[model samples]
Target: MTGNLWTAREIAQQPDVWRTLATSLDADKPRIDAFLAPLLAKEDLRIVLTGAGTSAFAGQILAPGLSRTLRRRIDAVATTDLVSNPREYLAEDVPTLLVSFARSGDSPESLAAVELAEEVLSECHHLVLTCNPDGQLYRNTAGEHSLALLMPEGTNDRGFAMTSSVTSMMLAALTVLGANPDVTLLADVAADALPDLAKRARVLAEDGADRFVYLGSGPLTGLARESALKLLELTAGRVVSYFDSSLGFRHGPKSVLNPATVALVYLSNDPYTRRYDLDIARELRADLPEGQVITIGCRDDAEEETWSFPGLGHLPDATVAPVLLLAAQHVALATSRALGLDPDNPFPGHEVNRVVKGVTIHALDE
Candidate 1:
């Protein structure tokens, strides 16, 4: 029972967890570069970013930014879609790069999607980012054409939800696509700032906003989705949650806004994206809701109190504000505890595990 105690304190102190995971990417760069070289060289390369559930959200966070950075046609597609209609998702005419993000590569949909891609596409390359090295995705790619980047150990959380693992895999994808992110610097900043973020998040969680809406543009939208899910899952649905892109929120979703709701917007550093994000913030500020609208970003000249991180230049745009997510996690944990829900096992009757369960993988016909 010695190592069995899974407390937030312990989870927070796991040996430069962020840095270790970040540094591991150094070895992956060359492999990634080699794999991506020919694909990038092609006049028309279609990059499809995919996964299931949270993994799928990782793609949502990265695709837009990656498209802008690499100047390639990148799209985020859920493996669930690939499972249902493989041909529709896979393109055969042009060279393609498939980036699959998974906490546990064993997900039936994850494995099947890979099989489907190879079967349906004449030319396809793969980049697999996962925590489980022994998972099918890693095992299947041995001596093959793909590259699999395994995250630092213990990142494969044993709890019912993914915390560190999700962030780690997302970082891996960002590193491979480009950025050449400095893991050590980003990790140091995150680790140092977490304690304070945790304290503030607890206060917010305790305030008990009836409805929570997360807003962000580009890659941060994925972070917003993950943030909303953490609160929803950790609180066992005690708090209702939703997410939307910054500009898109005004179309209709803004109707949900009221005095009793908490709206969190993740701002971008890019002027174009930030302009839209700030516009929404201005509207929210003008409405004067009784509830709070918190903005997390690197640049914060807005009138409201903003949470800004000073040394986040080493991270990619999608990753820069992730420390803000640590705050969200803390809020979820503290709020769940305050509501008398166990943070470790929020859903008592739910059988979901850290890796996942009850998934049946079928044999692909050769």
Candidate 2:
């Protein structure tokens, strides 16, 4: 392992990466603000937040909040879907704004989706958020009618899983979408809280379980899916994991609950959403085997291993929940390493690079 590479162990200790990514927002804020001004000013705007896998989830975590904050029509559409079925997702009349988040920006779906949007939509603008400056998405946007924001160096995680890159991109999206009441303050809070968060995650990961379930409501549900996949990917399928909405789980998915399983419930600060999450948590605590439930939230009053975001009020929106997801990723990374797996390259034979593989872009006649 190089000095710059992050072992699962090192990732657990370096909470400062979270802080560094958060604090860097101040410097990037003006640029993001200027880039987004024209898009935000338009009332006829339809924003699409997109990417593949974890990058796709970044949009999921931000879209609901961005929609509410910007008071504009915004949707989290997967690049995979946009690439395969462009007509279903790409509408013609609206002035579209596509926000693409990618760690490497070279993923076939990532780049292809951008090209598809430009080719299919009449009026479309782009905001490319990526860590690699040389990434295809970043390079292609140069001098074009698009805005590109590159994350801090080293954010391009060497690991198969995305940690800092995911959180940083989420933060950048939130900042650009106008969610922060005080950008500096929110960034400071995230920066200060990360170290302690990582420490706690390490402890949790050490206490192993055979299976894991991640639950959330609204936009957080999508985040729950991403979190579950992270553990699954990093562990190379050693740990069986699943994700669903709090209410949706009870329909049939709750049957997977057992003494050997760990259930992670993401509670919302909004009463409407929290009521459903808490109800499920309470039920899980009562019916499931003891010591199987772990709850994470921004509130102070949950019974289980509750994670809180003090000094932060009820966001009433899932947009803010992405900030809290950093801890969860830390836990997953630590757990993967605890199981004796190499976090950097979980699947040696998979042949999937940071960019991706097995894709050929088709040429379109002008």
- Over 198-315, each residue of candidate 2 has an lDDT whose tens digit, in order, gives 6877777887875899999888898898889888887788899999999999899988887778888888777777789888888888876766677777654434336666544456
**Candidate 1, 232-286: lDDT as tens digits:** 8777888888899998888998888767888888877776777888888778877
The C-alpha TM-scores of every prediction are: 0.89, 0.89
Clashing pairs in 1: none
Best by lDDT: 2
